[model samples]
Target: MSEHKDNAVAETVLVSSSSQPSQKVRQTAPVSAWNVLVQGIALFSDGYNVQIMGYMQTVMAKLYPKQLTSSIKTRLSNSILVGEVIGMLLFGLCIDRFGRRVGIIATTAFLVLGIILSTAAHGNTVTGMFWMMIVSRGVAGVGAGGEYAVCTAQALESADSSASLQKRRGFLVTISTNLAIVSGFVGSSIVSLIVIAAYGNKASEGIWRVCFGIGIFLPLTIFFVRMSLLDSSQYQKHAIQRRVPYMLAIRRYWRPLLGCSLAWFLYDFVVYPFNLLAPTLVSGFTKNPTLLQSVGWSALINSFAIPGAIFGGWLTDRIGRRQTYAVGWAIVCVLGFLIGGLRFPLRHVFPLFVVLYGFFQSFLSVGPGDCNFLVSSESFPTPLRGHFLGFAAAVGKAGSAVGTTVLTIALNSFQNQTKGQQVLFFIGSSISVLGTLVVIFMIPNHPATLEEEDSKFREYLEENGYDTSEMGLVEKH
Candidate 1:
């Protein structure tokens, strides 16, 4: 409206709704709540399946000691991560290109099929069975990975689509996605413990099979629910199913893109390996290192991350995503170095070790674990949201694949596992300190709205000789 305001601009609005909260909520909350709920289950299923593999590997190692080696265990554990990397990229592009609905339905099917296949995995030899399981889980992983792109973006867009939901967008997205993820991790541990205890705490053929089977429950229950999901208003209003301006997006958004991707990469790197092996770490120092004992303790460790996510989500809404992320990383960096420094003294004190260890993990959740999803989804425009979010998440999952391998390698390299755990603390801390700096510099503090950034992006495109007309009111057949 004014020539004086030249560059990309948006007015910071506290409340976009002119009507009463109840009326506004009644109109908008159903679809928003539906998306969050189903996606929560989607994330829950993803986390449950992804996490149980580590426990499966642990059980399989004990069951078929002659067949399962460190190499095979590592391969088994990383298979899903590798599959997730593939799924996120492919589904993300497709979600942007086709529609979010297609991606959601397809990924859910993949998750269900993969879990079913992995559950019933069989072969002539024990090693063959393990390989079959790996391939099966990898297939499930692709579905899980695609959920990161499809589900997260869908939830974020749902929040954006509603005026009533916009203010609480950060918290809603964080709780619905990240909290579900952490809960899934915790659920896997609990489920594994219960299943193993029922099977006499002995790693056997049935125990591994049953563990994989349970992952299918959430996904199977939510399949029809996912089908019921219509594309969000943001996707509808801004869908560019035709020729997308990829070069324009990269040119305009590269800095924040780099920041979000690196932040996600670093977050996944620390959390996936550490959370997966929490049992090993806790058991290293515990006097009673029973299968049930280690996994039960691991469940406790995973549970601590939940509060951090809850608080981080609330804080992200109040303070800002970048600020909350930075604070979390800052605390994590300090706690990690302290943990590494005191590894010797804390070796004997299991309670203190867990308190510190759990706190460290909780902060990891606070930082990139929860916030990265918000940062990735919120920082970009809605039309191309799936593309960018998927790419960033795919990059992060790639880091997770590498991190899991490296951590396992580090654990094996150390004659004393304690030393390996200490190294992990140091490495996690070092990465976190870098993350704090990156958040401060690269990550932009985006305004709270469904379309603030999207509007700016649309204007930027129209100005640059790109067709903005192709972006609005797109109906999928």
Candidate 2:
């Protein structure tokens, strides 16, 4: 048994018998197609619920005609953000200790619960429905917050630990990010068609309910599919010992935790307001009163954004994380300056601005928590990876909550909606510029491979005066 253990650990690349003695070769495992599809589907839920709210805002405005104050409107929309913070924190911790499969399944359940609760609320009074919307959105937000961190970590870890896989990691992760933006387009289209069909030629009071109720179907399908999603390959090792504690992971991986958290803070500060309030901005510009019309336009805008997201991810892999994200900021600055200063009234200028906004927004979708999976999954050894990711997720969720709350305050403080929209665009753009600088200067230029990271961890443990011999690797004196 001891000899077998030694041989397994000592095994190196096996050259083919046909190869010359001087010929050197490498062996790599095949990528799992099933795993990739499962990962994509699992991640779809994250964007599905969040994007639906963007389309649902106009419906909400009609349902609560009197409560359109910036503060109330912002609060109702951001309530999900608050819940997402909690869900991100909880799932991160649970995934580390319990397993990734549990975290994914549990969060999906929250999404289903939210849809059910939201649907039930529509049958009640306006105020009752508002509170219900708040609760449901919160549940959906929590699920989203968890899904972002866990899914990225799971997918990256499953790939071959080689330079080739490292290069492709960005692309694989991009698939989920790109699809999520596309989901916004899908949600918008669905809401548009439903609203138009249910009350064709005249908007009805119940159209919003129908839209919210439709959210239930996706989550329900996910619930059935998720049952078969066992723990990811990365989590199996930690799942067995049950020895890795959440607190220990936090103490051990503080550098990555801090870096990921701060980066997400800046990204979230920008994304939350922009995504949740985009439709509102369109309405402010277009003066369109029809919910179906607003949703259709918003959907069209998001479809344009999806390509930008795919492009950003490709750029991340081709250039590097820092340069790719920096370019995204440059685009944001250009778009922000124009949107803030330009006053277009349905001329070609307005549509052009809308298209630009959608295009630049894709960069943000990649920024917040997208590639941090590389950092989080590789920063810690297999034993502690899940906990670190979960903690970072919680931090990101907190930033989103802050952004949402700030937007609520900004809009509510002003009596005019136009002023509120301008304020949001200005703040979101400014914060993004600052964040881009942080990523450029503060973050390391390249990701560390597994062996490099393990060696660094040993050094870090030595410097901090902790014994890491049980990590099954040598330690620096």
TM-score of each: 0.92, 0.79
Please give the distance, in angstroms, between residue 405's alpha carbon in candidate 2 and its true position after superposition: 4.2
1-477 per-residue lDDT for model 1 (tens digits) = 232122111111111111212111222566667778788888987888888877777777677888888778778877888889889889988888777878877898888889889888889987898899889888998999999988898888767655567778898899888998989988999899999999988778888788888888888788888776666656656667778999999999999899999988888888888887787888766676778887888889989999999999999889989999999999999999999999988978989998999999899988778888899988888778888888899889888878877877887788987888889889889988888998999999876675667778888998999987767543223
Steric clash pairs (candidate 2): 70-412, 71-412, 92-390
The residue pairs found clashing in candidate 1 are none
Which lDDT values do the candidates have, in the order given? 0.81, 0.60
Which stretches of model 1 miss by more than 4 angstroms? 1-27, 474-477
Q: Over the stretch 1-477, how does candidate 2's per-residue lDDT look in tens digits? A: 343222222213221111223222222334333444456676665566666666666665665667555555666667776777777677767666555666767887787787778766753656666776787778877776777656765665544244455556666666654455356446546665666667773555566667667666766676666555444333332232333344544676666567766766777676666666666667665665566667766666666556666676677678776566667766776677666655343234676767667765765655533444444454465545655666666666677778877876787677876666666677777877776776666555544344444455446655766554443211123
- Give the number of the best model, judged by TM-score: 1
Candidate 2 local Cα displacement, residue 176, angstroms: 2.1
How far off is residue 169 in model 1, in Å? 0.5
- 177 in model 2: Cα distance from truth in Å? 4.2
